[model samples]
Target: MNIDSITNGVVIDHITAGAGMRLYELLGLGELDCSVAIIKNVQSAKMGKKDIIKIDALIPIDFDVIGYVDPGATVNIIRDEKLVEKRTIDMPELLTGVIKCKNPRCITSVEQELDHVFRLTDRAGKVYRCIYCETKAG
Candidate 1:
């Protein structure tokens, strides 16, 4: 109810109501020493109900992971208490290290150092398949 405005940081907005925590963990915000806020199920006119993550620090974010998890999310950059930039997320065509191939036979599973790579196979359905074994990403 009384969330303080960030002086310089990013505000991740319009998260699909329950996906805030997933986004928070996936982004490795837990490793940071800065203040981070996860606001869930907030009333929204455009989205009906939404989740928001407010990072009280400016840091590099993996857009691919964010897009893959929640394509409808938005990122707002706040600088000096003013919104400086706003970004709308869309599904990524290619993803690397954003998700893992669940297939046990996938080369990535055997090669511990190999990056988990996936390509968009069905845009409308948001389907992605592993590049090595063609295993569908869950």
Candidate 2:
């Protein structure tokens, strides 16, 4: 309830209520050495309920991963305990290594060295298809 503000770090805000943990895992935040806080199910006027993630260290984050998990999320950069920049996430057109192709016959399954890639096929539906076998991502 009393989370301190970060001086130099990134804050991921407006995450879909239940999607924060998935985003956290996919982004590999658990592997970082810095302090990170995940606040879930916070009341939000706009979203009804939302999740927030605060990182206590400035580190490189793959925006594509955030976009893929929660396109409506926002990223805030803080420096000197002040907001330096704010970014609204959008679905990415291409995803590489963010998700693995599930198709058993897909080349990625056989060729372990190849990167699992997907392309946005339907923006309206947020459908992603594996580039290797055109298998729709689940």
Candidate 3:
């Protein structure tokens, strides 16, 4: 195993490799004006397989969008080669514009002009339903 060191950046760990690009697209990382190091298919002690994203700048997190999609992920803020903050995200019940409804027939999915909208069922339940088509997330 080869672990390269980053001088300064935030490292997102334990992301699913398949979701890596989707994560980037959803987070608007590619559009951002910053150097980003995206590492996928890394060996992990806990996850067995994992992906990591290193951003060479501080980006304020949209926690509501993050928690719902990447609960298994962790964000480690780096400063001068040291980890400044380690944030473990919990599942969020409510979200807006982060994910499209999986159901093809859902209005949000069908209508490119409309933004995806979700309603929180129970904060504790972490359950959300789409507003346009009323598709429940299981």
Candidate 4:
């Protein structure tokens, strides 16, 4: 509960409860050599309970992954212990490399060099379909 404020870093907020670890893994935060904090089930007036991730370093992050995982999440850039920018994550219209095509007949299955791509076809249903095979992503 005594997480220190970062001098310069990114704060991922409003994550759905129990999703902090998945985001951490998906973002490859474990590979970084900087202070990273994952706070889960924190009280939130709007969301009841939410998760937050604070990285104590200014590093590049894949916003697509964040959008896919938690579209409502917010990214706050901190510099000199002050918030410099705030970005609201929204579901990306196109996704590449964030998820893999599971269809066995898909080209990506055989072509190891091919990037698994998907397009948001139904925003209301949060549905995505593979661009190559048209197979719906789970």
**Candidate closest to the true structure, highest TM-score:** 2
Per-residue lDDT of candidate 4, residues 1-138 (tens digit) = 789889999999999999899899989999999989999999999999999999999999899989888898999999999999999988999999878889999989999998889999999888899999999987
> Where's the lowest-lDDT run of ten residues in candidate 4?
64-73
Tell me which residue pairs clash in candidate 1.
none
How do the residues 95-131 of candidate 2 rate in per-residue lDDT, one tens digit apiece?
A: 9999999999898999999999899999889899999
Superpose all Cα atoms of candidate 3 onto the true structure and report the RMSD in Å to 1 decimal.
3.5
| 1 versus 3: better TM-score goes to | 1
Whole-model Cα lDDT of every candidate shown, in order: 0.92, 0.93, 0.76, 0.93
Better of 3 and 4 by lDDT: 4
Model 1, which residues run further than 4 Å from truth? none
**TM-score quality measure for candidate 4:** 0.95
lDDT of 1 by residue, 20-39 (tens): 99999889899999999999
RMSD of each: 0.9, 0.7, 3.5, 1.0
Q: How accurate is candidate 3 locally (lDDT)?
A: 0.76
Estimate the TM-score of every prediction.
0.96, 0.97, 0.75, 0.95
Candidate 3 TM-score, true structure as reference = 0.75
How do all the candidates rank in terms of TM-score, highest first?
2, 1, 4, 3
Query: In model 3, what lDDT does residue 107 have?
Result: 69
